[model samples]
Target: MELVIGIDIGGTKTKIGLVDKEGKCLEDTFFRTKEYPDIDDYLDKVVATIEELKDKFNYANILGCGIGAPNASSKNGTIENASNLLWKGTVPIIKKLNERMPMPMRIMNDASVAALGEMLFGNAKGMSDFIVITLGTGFGSGIVANGKLIDGFDGFAGELGHIDMTLGDGRITGLGVKGGLEAYVSATGLKRTIMYMQSKYLDESRFRSIAYNDLHGEDITKAAEEGDPIALKAFDYTAKILGLALANFTAFTQPEAFFLLGGLVNSGKWILDPLHTYFEEHLLEVYKGKVKLLSSGMEGKTAAISGAASLIWESHTDEY
Candidate 1:
């Protein structure tokens, strides 16, 4: 039984898993990433977890490890200046992991790993060209063109979140970019929309009683489900931006489909329906009705684990 360790590093939490070639996470656990301010302590815990998984499973062959993190670079084997992380500088991820566990390992940003996972195991399995957008704490994207992951000159490609789409007055992102796509369309973005709508529109709803800090994306989705006008309007607003941007993206690579993943995707049709409408309506005549928008085959922790583990198998393909 050949297995690989998959680690998904997030801003607040980290998901660790033992995965096989079939895209299954046999054993998994969650760890607090923010709690450890030091990278050495964090690596020690991760290495310990891997050792426990190996011993418990008793697999004949334990293959390499794959890590998906914010601002991670496969070329440099380090995570560089990630805004959401506690670490302030470039952390040598592969070097630290290799010191404890001697095995073949790979590292890439979360979105890139997710895109690779989609190509290997998710809905975009057979597609040669596609994009995966992650709408979590922030908006992120991974692009696969001609069946190869495009890592740009230094592994920082497909950063759709930072693209300028506004008049530079929109909400400031973690990286201090105003009007960035992530600040308007992510789960955090949805919350901002709800609060803004509450101020402008005097809609009498449950959200009125909830404080701005207390409100969440899920709360907005629940409100929309119950026919709350404010919540519905928020989705429309968020979707239009995402749709227009996605439509514009078609001209770049003309992907066969765009797969949506992460927390905001859980809103289901509330987000998808309007996104499709706006995307199709705004698409250029040449690209109209040719591309598709698909949901992720695996969402949440499973998607992260499977995506990270997919890197272990990524070498088998000629496409990188």
Candidate 2:
């Protein structure tokens, strides 16, 4: 059997998956990324896991290895200053991996890989043009046009989170940018929206009583699920920003649909219901009633690992 190794590198956990061409994960195991503050230590553990998986699944011929990570440069197979990671500077991931395993290696931003996964195995399958917007700790996007993922000249494209909304609302992103989409539409943004509303509305709400540091994402989700007015209003506000931004994004690629993924998406109808209404309202006449906003067909680490592995199958789509 022919298989490929897939790795999904995140801030907290790294998942190593052995997958077939059909995107089935025959086996998967993970190590804590945070435990290895030094890049070399991290890579050592990752490589060991890969070898263990290879030994356990000895019958399969592993073709290549693909990886998805933050602040990754697919063009260079290096990670450049990923804020979530403890290590500094650009790490030559491919070189290190090759020194150990010695196979074809490819890497890209995690969100971009998720988009690739969607194209190969999820709802976006057979669709040429679509966008995958992940609403997680921060906003991340993967744009597909003309049946190919867009990895620009330097492999730093598809950064939709940095789109400036020019709200002038004083909400600054971790990137130190003001009015960026991620500052208004991500999970971080949602929490900020709740806090802002808590101050402005003077409404009797659980969020108001809870300290900012003590609050949890799940708490807010539960409140919204139960129809808490403050949480609902916050969702409405956040969705409007995202909906408008998504409408504008259509002008660039004219994608047939926008597939949403990540933790914030778990809020379900609390966010999606309002998002659809606003997205339709703001879309240009030429594009109205055409672009669909839907949840991602594939979810969690499995899809992500498959997405990373799918890079090996593509002839040129975001190839390193």
Give the number of the best model, judged by TM-score.
2
Give the per-residue lDDT digits (tens) of candidate 1, residues 1-320: 88878899999888899887777888888889988899999999988877777788884487789999999988999999999999988899899989988999999999999999888877888789999999998999999998898899988898899887877877888788998998889998999888888888998888888887898878888999999988998999999999999998998999999998888989989999999999999999999999999888865557898899999977744443
Worst 10 residues of 1 by lDDT: 311-320
| lDDT (CA) per prediction | 0.89, 0.87
For candidate 2, write residues 1-320 as lDDT tens digits: 88888899998889989987667788898989999998888888998899899998788888899999998989999999888888789998989888987888999999999998888867888899999998899999999999988999999998899878885655788888788889888888888899888877977788867887787678888998887888988999999999999999998999999999988988888888999999999999999999998777764658888889888866434322
**Residue-level error in angstroms, candidate 1, position 165:** 0.6
Candidate 1 Cα deviation (angstroms), residue 41: 0.8
Q: Which runs of model 2 end up more than 4 angstroms from their true locations? A: 167-169, 316-320
